[model samples]
Target chain A: MNMPVSQEKKKIFVTVGTTQFDELVTRVLHPDMLEIMEAQGYTHLIIQIGRGPEPQIPTSQRIQITVYHLKESISSDIKDASLVISHAGAGSCLEVLHAHKPLIVVVNQKLMGNHQLELAEKLHSERHVVMCYPETLKTTMTVFNTSSLENLPINNQMALSNYIEKLMGF
Target chain B: MGSGGHTGEMVRLLSTLDFRHFSPRLYLVARTDDMSAKRVQQLESSHISTAGLFQTVSISRSREVHQSWITTIVSFLQSTLECLRILFYYQPDLILCNGPGTCVPPCIIALLLRVLWIKRSTVIFIESICRVNTLSLTGKLMVCFLADRSIVQWPELHAKYPQTVFLGRLV
Candidate 1:
């Protein structure tokens, strides 16, 4: 049977940057979760698994899956993504937010101090990214819409430049 | 700088610099952290006009994640000595750091140099953007005495500290 013409290629990119969160990789690939994504009209799932074991993909019917360990840079992948699911590292979160993509930040609760949770929660309050634990990722995905989110402030990264210039008397 | 988020943020911050004025830059990473060295190189080649305008120096991490307190003393002293050597050799005009354990020793050395009227290397420390409600241990130390200019990314931190400059998302 021919696929419906209305079905377009929508890719969901899941990244755990520079650190392994095996639980996220496992949870997102669970058949139930795949069905959720399929129901939501996503056609592809690309995962960047950082220092983790290669994920086992169940024999699939509809959605396509791709996995890789790392990349020199992930900005291109992020740019191509329809929605991004990322670990709650500041680097990954900032990259996605700066790209203005809809994001779901999965907090790695196993880590000590849980500063990642703090960052995710703060962003969630601002409606910039949705925050969920690995255990809740399925439910979060089932309800998540890639349509609406707030914009981050136009990057003030240049402010640091001016401050450094002033300090150095340049 | 340390690896992971620390290096990522520092690289982003450094990329904002006008390399013409800040040429001959020095990046100090944990001696074992090859990843950060690679990142610094990437940032330099992409952002700077010339190669060899920047140099990277490797030093031991003053405190590693989950390191025990007893061994921390030894590692901290070792890193402190290394930072002293590096600073004395370079006597750089400015020292910029974020909240990595590797940064503490250099900040201390910079403060000592300033207090002794030997070198006036202005030290600036930025708290990680992750710190929303509370400061990291290194952040508290910088606020207490180390930094000449302390910056925080979140407005809540500035409201709590009052002393830190809130510049709103520096990296």
Candidate 2:
């Protein structure tokens, strides 16, 4: 069944969040992946490759993939995204979750220590995000359709807000 | 604020703040941190009435994860002086900071002010949710000596640092 033209154009924002994750970038920009993304209705793939060499992907007529070396603000990209594919950085994860965007968090194993992996596991267990390793990304993407991702529970800031309010004695 | 995830978490925590009560807010970022500054500006533009309510200051980082000790000491001294200048000018009632090496200078300045009986700004530190087993370098140093209140997002962290409050995940 063909979906409406308006509904067919989805935007996917890919970011490595300050550090280099060349592995993930290479995986995403693979021709097979691009073809799959296009088939799945992604019209735009906005990639923020932080501190990493530019990804080499041939321009496709079907999917408009834009790559940036680094961006000062990705809020606009996040806001425009139908899905967010990101490194397991707390900032990126929180931003995507806060925006209520469907997210696939790829853990960068090269990072020093287990913090990133722990965070990814925690969020994955909570069903807040889909987590995958760089090597498993292709298979993960194949099995994991965007429709399977549930809308994340809205983060409740009121607890902290009220706590701060009382701390300020206001 | 530190760049990347630290900035994002700080923004979330700040978002919950009653800006009416926390007027004339002073936001500090590392000199090279275009990302954090931009994120803070975006937050300010959306929620607050006008940009005039808050100010952004860019200071230097004391140390990178891997840097020479001499460079660290020099940067620390420079950043400390910068923090002192800002503290004197602002004299804020409360200083809210998350885990970042950049936070150390201002926090030290705040502690010194309290010791000198010059100023008494409550210094609150929130450890990043990313920290699961061990405290970040900044958290380990600040919680024991400086911060008036330190919070952890994970129960395990709070268990490890029993003094720090466990408020659950900020994200």
Candidate 3:
């Protein structure tokens, strides 16, 4: 008689939001990073490449990998993810934080305005997310700890509605 | 509403509204943005109570990313004319927009209409949550003269610009 072993599936979802961040995409798809992610016990890797170049898979990887260009909404992906590694876009960060999942925000310095850097740094300082530059992404991933993360409060949607109603005299 | 970030936040904000009170919502999208239209449909359909109460209109983009200054003037003027036509026809009671380059022309037109005794449409501008320390170009331009009320999601921005109201992360 043999005992059945239950296998757990852990997924890491990487998103670059609507804008292209080729550096973050390329760095995440590197074989070395794949090895690191696998070693960290992530059984599945999903990448939302956005407008970046298509990913090419290396033949020798044991973990499962899925890549797609874009989606109407990434809420389901964020829900399924055990960990989310995303670009420092405000929308993506807020969505992940709203889900109360562990998040690693990788800043794209090549972006023209570079407002993402400030946003990411602020969130990191507040301990809501782990912020790192694309160059340091690998190191950050290797040392990432989910228990250190904190969830941001759900926003009061009524506040804006009430204010607008009062201003509009409704 | 303009780019994906702006559209996403606006949709989330509007989802909280009482559609019956704020009926006939008009969403102005940038000509270059196709995603926002689909998002609008999703938002409308999800709330069956507000079906057919809101619609989206496409306006020329005021400026494209990395556009040169000289060509920006031409596009800006083109968009301003389009906004003028739209606002003249609708004359909405309230115009709500977050910071996006596409919002600038419409807000300016709304302000012009109110000043000229044409029709009063209150314009509200909400700064993007991404702006932590400083204001975006659109925020700077609208804070003083364009918007009837300017709101910021971050205390830092509200403190720096006393003109902006802090609603504590509306988006």
TM-score of each: 0.95, 0.84, 0.96
Q: Which clashing pairs does model 3 show?
A: none
Off by over 4 Å in 1: A1-7, B48-52
Which whole-number lDDT from 0 to 100 does residue B139 have in model 3? 89
Give a tens-digit lDDT track for model 2, residues A78-166: 99998889999887887888788889999988877657777778788878889998888877777776666666565555767777778
Ranking by DockQ: 1, 3, 2
- Mark the regions of model 3 whose C-alpha exceeds 4 Å error after superposition: A1-6
Give me the chain B TM-score of candidate 2: 0.94
DockQ of each: 0.81, 0.54, 0.77
Error of 1 at B74 (Å): 1.2
Which predicted model would earn the best TM-score? 3
> What is residue A7's positional error in candidate 3, in angstroms?
2.1
Chain A TM-score vs. truth, each candidate:
0.93, 0.85, 0.93
Residues B1-171, candidate 1: write the lDDT tens digits.
Answer: 788999999888888878888668899999889999999888887985553477999998888778999999999999999989999889988888999999999999998888888899988898998999889999999988899889999988899999998888887
